[model samples]
Target: MSTAAVPDLAVVASPWTLGPLTLPNRVVMGSMHTGLEVHDDGGAGLAAFYRERAAGGAACIITGGIAVSDEARGGPDFAVFGVDGADERFRVAVQAVHDEGGTILAQLFHAGRYALVGGMVDRHGDPQRAVAPSALPWAAARGVVPEELTASEVERTIEDFAAAARSARDIGFDGVEIMASEGYLVNQFCSPLTNLREDAWGGTPEKRRRFAVSVVRAVRAAVPDLAVTIRLSGADLMPGSTTDDEVDALVHDLLPLGLDGISVGIGWHESRTPTVQAAVPHGAWLAYASRIARVVRGSDHPGVRVIASNRMTDLRDGEAVLADGLLDAVALARPFLADPAIVSRSVDGRFDLVNTCIGCNQACLDRSIIGAPVSCLVNPRAGREVAFPVRPTTQPRRVDVVGGGPAGLAAAVDAARRGHRVTLWEAADELGGQFGLAALVPGKEDYAATVRAARAELDQRGATVHLGRPATAADLVGSDAVVLAPGVVPRSVDIPGVELPHVQTYEQALRDGVPAGTVAVIGGGGIGVDTAAFLTESPDESLRARAFAERWDVTVADDVLGPLPQRQPVAQRTTRPGEQVTVLRRSGKFGQGVGLTSRWVALGRLRDAGVRMVGGVQEYLRIEPGALWIRDEDGVERAVPADHVVVCAGQERLEHSLESALASAGVPFALVGGARDARSVDAVRATSEALEAVRSLAP
Candidate 1:
């Protein structure tokens, strides 16, 4: 091993060769489901999507899961190799990426018991049933048990894998990454919990390894010159699953198979460890990849590249990881969704201009989980590159956006990008309206980065931003069009002692700390859940691997934290551990409106904080010095005692007088975001509305 000092940026920018392919840099655009794979656009939108990202400077791109067979299809949105005209579509996508000087790969995937099948038909016009190693059903999708693949059927599946690889090479792909990670078919065969068979496939460790080994061997024989890589689960993060020693042994056994690369994947879909959540910290899973890298480097094929992935949101973070020389490359999936030009912007030292992924899951993962069309919350034109093309308009107009929140900021930036003269005004001293408040929450520290990037983009586009005051009606007199997004105000509950001195709204409590004692909070919506997290916040929500694992009950193996895991903390102060917080809800889930993937994690944090949760409250009678009176759903009146009170009922639309004034003066104006409708503080809807509003007002 060589010991030398390389600048952090230089480390990640350095290029390396993976067998037949020579990548330009260490950043790989990792695979993510865009939900546009099955769109009826003849693959035009999908082709354009990858084309722009390649042009933006990703060294290599990995396509979303491409099923090897119809039974292996994950859902209706999955693109299969030989079904539904996906082969012709993939050929176009591959050419598009190559034209822009980027290499693309086809990830061969099989969902096993995780497949979502309903109306899919086979060759004989019969409903296709999901096939797995055993006849067990994934607990998450309880009602559907998968059929155990017969001995002959399993051998045919191996051939199907080989056939898919041959087709991928024929279609002009630079590589083929066998999907053996994230609780998929290959991963299921490795885990004892999922694979229960007395046959040659699952009697022991070596037998369990047969399926993945045979698949890799077949795929390699079919495509000899192509990069033959396999993605393996470095850590399943599931209790009573595959052990670390078993995982390392599997890699040791596959060393002489002429493999080109290995990409490390972490966690399972059913794991509760919070692997990719915002609270997991940046580059939290690198140690798993480093461990695999060490195992490979000590073997005969040390030249095989090893890639680290998961929660790598910034290039600077990736640079730091590469500086240690433990891993060869860094793969980022969602960061590319937040900014396709991330590689170009970060390499050029334009960090402020890069839109960072906040890990809110509002638009990406939440939508993809349910098979909906996926888009970015910050970069709205992510999947729709053709529909929302960014170019100079033939005729530009003077457009003014009021309120410098999520909606207003998005509108102002997009309007300026279209060659319009744009100006944004905010009543506060700074921008980021609700985002500013959100940044104060414990796990949401990344929200502040969004504000920083948005502010820089406004300046770069020559769009003026006025702070410390609201947009006056006179200021909009000469504007050709006005977009109002004044945002929302807290709604007051009709309780008798609501205006008590000790009571405060959710906004005030988040911005300024509440009283340091027992507190009773009303309502259990998203904001209320955030309030609970804030009130019961730790002295410091640590970014170190051990602390995170300990907090979430993930038993990390001995040396998985790596050497440089603890250099910073999100917060560090004295916390009142014994302080009690009682949360009351009327009727529903506690963390409603929180993203589907994130709600459980947030609730887990609150549970660890020793919060007293009570639901089914029918009435809020009154409040006094010691406690608040309320009636329960059991037809019983009781007093919830507390030292302080917080109300998080909901939000109301901020009535903009400027809208009526602009209309009276014959100025064309439109209300967007919370100023138009304030059902909840929905940033996904806000950014979507802002994008549509700006595009509709084209020159």
Candidate 2:
């Protein structure tokens, strides 16, 4: 296959300058919470995190929000710029990025009322108090109200900002971006909703802008040669919050402070109008930055640059926004998590190969909230970049990838990229296996993007793809190693009524179509409920709603009577009146078939969708010319009506007894997809295992 032409991804030189430096690219690595910092040492881990991105291709890497004062720290692990004796560590972090040929920026911040001081103990092990504009706490809690910043305290805080900036410059940082957005301290003072003080720093927009403007001015003065940037919230997006005009007026007033650039972020997750809770589309936050750019263009600060960021994942979106003069640069957060080489791939015209972020939030923000090391849901090698760097093998070997799902694809891509000759075999005509079924769920189209990206990468790396081929142990006779990635198979119970014509497996219903109407899905496991939900779609309601309805009809059957034990909701599940749905759950060990997280979401959706729960159906009997006859837990036989029955039980690993047949024939073989295992997770794992096995056998 001929190589495709790459796109022109060269960074445009901006005429606008920042202090004594000029950025070559408009792609800025925005300040992101990695939850990898060590509270005690504040060491090289955080520094290396920034340096890796710099080495990957970011023009400017902004450090995660670093609190300038002890009282303003949001969490215990947040990096602190004011920590005593921490200057050397911060200097090393800055130098790491500088050594990697990238500009580094420190984001100085104060959490204000958002501070978890009382919840977070000081280094002395004393519980601290949280401070804010008013007595208002976060929406989720009503803990201790913060004492309003006194006139002297406010002045000291401004000095802290300047001091932090000065310290950042001393540590070799190219500049400092004041984090004034996302409902932090500066943002609290900037908005009327948060700052209700009668002091000079409150009331009107001009008064509210005082604290931020002072910080910018003081920081610029402290670090004359270092570029000073302001990260502002263009609009609070909260009810009774700062309006666009109010934000515009504040920007206009603050532009003359000689700041180098502006970054516009959105929504406070804890605020009534939190960005995380908002259902806004991708790049929805760019409009605010565009408005800021227009305001700056009208003012004397035409040379001031503007950066836009908010869930931006596609380079095309960034390119269009920049081309239209909406903003000077676009910032991406999750996309970088999904694929660190996004810019490199785009420049190489391999957009299809880009492993797109599905916005599942499972590994990124979700994991951080639970105090786990951050990772990507689809890409397991995210935070482990340095630990598991993909290097070319000294000797080329043949690698066979049995399953073509996410894990298999990742393994194949990695092995092939490492200079191995890889062969990926799929039992099915297409790839993805169970993930393909997942894509059919509402709001899950993004999952399919992972498969597409894997296929693209495999094609690019010249991995041989053999479709509709199932390999056995004999196929690995001459191979030095063998990987068994045969995917999973459905685990079906030998129920009396399950053999009826209306009964079908979840996979069958997905690949083949079922008539729309009332449907009873057996088992309330993730796959069962998900399969039921996928059938509820009519191309009218939102995908989320349809998925919810499907989830509702699925239930966990309990044989012990009383009430059915519930699983957590996966997608929002809802069912309309008169919708035909029933869930049968067996007692004891028979019902535990799904992962905990997926089970929760699935159960929640099932209950919300009004799915009927029928438990203890061990002795179901078919009633001729009417409903089906069944026996309850008390050994009582009963009759229940149903149009179609779908089996959603668990799956088993793939088993092929024909290994000797193919191996004896001296066939170069591979196994792929669900033919490896009945379980989805195992199926993905098998793909890589199979690939490694093939490589070992290759001479």
Best model per TM-score? 1
Give model 2's TM-score versus the native structure. Answer: 0.76
- Give me the runs in candidate 1 sitting further than 4 Å from their true place: 1-8, 539-546, 553-574
Per-prediction count of colliding residue pairs? 0, 44
Candidate 2 per-residue lDDT, tens place, 448-526, comes to: 7788888888888888887787655544454433344556767877766577677788888776656545566666555
> TM-scores of the models, in the given order?
0.95, 0.76
Identify the runs in model 2 with alpha carbons over 4 angstroms from their true place.
Answer: 1-19, 39-44, 82-90, 116-119, 139-148, 203-205, 271-280, 395-398, 478-483, 489-505, 519-699
Query: Could you give the C-alpha RMSD of every candidate to the true structure, in order shown?
Result: 3.0, 9.0
Error of 1 at 303 (Å): 1.5
